[model samples]
Target: MSFMKKHLKTLTIALGCSAGAFYLGWQSPTLMGDVFEQQQVAQPTPRFYPLERFIISVPGKEYQHYVLLELALKSSSANAKHQLAEADPLVRNSLMKMFAGKQVDELNKPKNLEQLQQEAKDLLTNVLSANKFAVKIDDVLFTRLVIQ
Candidate 1:
């Protein structure tokens, strides 16, 4: 009974501190969640810049073939469209060269088409980087694709 009386004050203080800590911890996630939501809201939306249509003849063993492609570049930059306009010729030439090398069979499969989209994105990013352009491409989207 004497020992309990001696430690009672210390135990009460410890319990009070623990309760306070638990209360703060319980509230922390709500505060942190609000901060995260605000950050997400502050982030810029992605912008897309469409390229002119491309009609290229593909060399074949027997008959002539062609591919019609329409592409759009996705970026977070506000000036992506203007920058792409400046680099349009080079972009078209690079894509044309890439498509020119593809056979009809290579472009026919759905799997191949997805691969081609990724390839185009990487290729455009490289082209923009090589030219020292300020624009960064996030993705390449094919708005239209026709092969015949």
Candidate 2:
């Protein structure tokens, strides 16, 4: 009974100190609002721009092959996507030229396709920046690729 009484006093004082610290450390609504705003400013949302299907013909050894490609691009700027849409014709023309030059055997390889996607990304970034577009594409995703 004596031990219980002595420990109870220590527990009560500890609780009081913890309660006081918590009360002092609690944030106000304005401070919380500022914290949330900082988090939002630090992280920006991603944006995607999808290009339509492209049917390109490349000459094979015995016959001409048809390649179907669909591309989606990712970036952080809406204005860049808008500019890409506005200059769709020029972008398509450039990509078509690149695609038309690929050999059917090369396109059939998975590694080559990955290289193609990377090349497309670099090419698109260069073209957009050179054309004075608002944003450059960070990635190129091939949603579909079929060769026939």
Candidate 3:
């Protein structure tokens, strides 16, 4: 009882300090809205550029197979999106040429599909760069793929 009484002030001071620290920490972020606003201004919203549906003929052992692919390119600027749109003819032709000789069996596998997506992104990025489009394709997304 005597020891508790002796340390009560110290404990009270420690608790008060912790509570004050927590309150300041919680309030600091709200006080710094300008910092957050600057961050938001620095980062641009992402954009997606979709290619029209692709239907390509793939070589098969006994019969020809058709692949239907829905693809979108992701970038950080509208300029990239506009560039892709302007070069739609070249883009479609390049992708069609890439997909033309692929085997149906290869497209059927999940691993092959992933590889195909990466390869397509690389090819498209290269083609766009070669054509003097100042945009980088960050990713290639396949929303729908069918091999039949």
Candidate 4:
């Protein structure tokens, strides 16, 4: 209907103008105001933290390399030590996975290494997030990913 089309056009114009105005205001630091504070509520609660990097051996390999991840874990040193003590098998299984889900090209290509690393991180995050209680790892990183 013509009426519907007109109302839609008006609504679109109003929304676009409002968005442009908000963007301009944000760019002008002098106009920083309470809106920023109100927007803060949309953010997620900050509890994820990165754990320290570790070098774990890969299957059929005789060497070890440091792996990094973009996880949100805390350095509860005592808790980590205790948990590892209690769940050594589970820990080993998780670490071994870093080597399992890999292709030689992905690990070897310097140009595509970033994409590979991101994929690894996403994979590890999905795996760890499933176990938010005991074997909880916020993310994974690969600091020294050498295939040797």
What order do candidates take by TM-score, descending?
A: 1, 2, 3, 4
lDDT at 128, model 1: 86
**Candidate 4 — what's its lDDT?**
0.51
Model 3 weakest lDDT span, ten residues long: 32-41
lDDT tens digits, residue span 9-93, model 2: 9999999999987775675445556654444445557787888999999999999999999988888775776687887987899
Model 3 bad stretches (over 4 Å) = 1-41
Residues 26-98, model 1: lDDT tens digits: 8876866775344444667898888889998877778779999998888998778788899999999999999
**Model number with the top lDDT:** 1
How many clashes does each candidate structure show, in the order listed?
Answer: 0, 0, 0, 11
Query: Can you give the lDDT of residue 118 in candidate 1?
Result: 92
Per-residue C-alpha lDDT of model 3 across residues 72-135, encoded as one tens digit per residue: 9888865886788788898899999999978888888997877988998899889988999888
Candidate 3 to truth, TM: 0.70
Model 1 alpha-carbon drift over 4 Å, by segment = 1-41
For residue 96, what is the lDDT in candidate 4? Answer: 57
For residue 70, give model 2's deviation from the true position in Å. 1.0
Rate residue 105 of model 2 by lDDT.
92
